[model samples]
Target: MESYGFIDCKDPKYVDTVKAIERELLFDGLLFRYKNNDDFGEPKSSFTVCTFWYINSLFKIGEETKAKNLFDQLLSNSNHMGLFSEDLDFKTKKC
Candidate 1:
């Protein structure tokens, strides 16, 4: 909803919904896409794409400073080769 400009952050409902989404999916500041339902069953970790999406949403919600800080943290989690897999370890800052 945030990506396609479907959400108007100025509106209270959109803000409430996004906040609820964030509250439900955010894990230790990282965003987890969803609960286990995939063929793989349970989730092993948070998806990197979701992290980017979360950051973008933060920007939309007027949290630029927090978004930038999280963006930096996300970059720091890249592997030594500057490579990223689908999943990242938030605690270790590694992929």
Candidate 2:
């Protein structure tokens, strides 16, 4: 997919940005939108769309194998009907 911006995917900054996101946002095989306390206090669930976008970014940055593995892991956590909610509990994997 096109980056939709001037920054090339191969650029060190872009790669490093993605790496930083993974380092700070990824948790328990899922991806949290952000860290730190918010109005609701610290986040307790993974933001589904943020995780998907991160997985896509991983693929765009040449981490296809890792992205695929994460994709599968996330998919496996979906409900039996193959549906996902906006948020998923970190421990229970429930919506």
Candidate 3:
């Protein structure tokens, strides 16, 4: 895909940029869309849709193994009925 209008994953600059962006968005290997607190100073948890997008990006960027692992973890976080919540409490491990 790099030859098809995609970023060159093997290029050093692109690789470094990808790593930097990943670091900024991920905490303890979990992805978050944002971390800023509201006016009440209560921060929002990781967004589940953002997490799914992150997993997809990982596969697109050639991190297949890690992406699969993260995808499995994300699935495990779903409710018993196979339902997913929008946000999660990372500390409490609650949805």
Best by lDDT: 2
Which tens-of-lDDT digit does each residue in 2-70 have in candidate 1?
Answer: 556876776777667668768888777677778757898866578888888778877877889988998
Candidate 2 global CA lDDT score: 0.90
Cand. 3 Cα-lDDT: 0.72
Best prediction by TM-score: 2
Q: Please rank every candidate by lDDT, starting with the best.
A: 2, 1, 3
Estimate the TM-score of every prediction. 0.76, 0.91, 0.73
Question: Residue 60 of model 1: what lDDT?
Answer: 79
Of 2 and 3, which scores higher on lDDT?
2
Q: Cα miss at 82, model 2 (Å)?
A: 0.7
* Poorly placed runs, candidate 1 (over 4 Å): 2-5
Question: Looking at model 3, which ten-residue stretch has the lowest summed lDDT?
Answer: 1-10
Per-residue lDDT of model 2, residues 1-95, tens digit only: 34688788878888898899899999987889888899999999999998999898889899999999999999988998999999999999889
- State the C-alpha lDDT per candidate: 0.77, 0.90, 0.72
Q: What are the per-model numbers of colliding residue pairs? A: 0, 0, 0
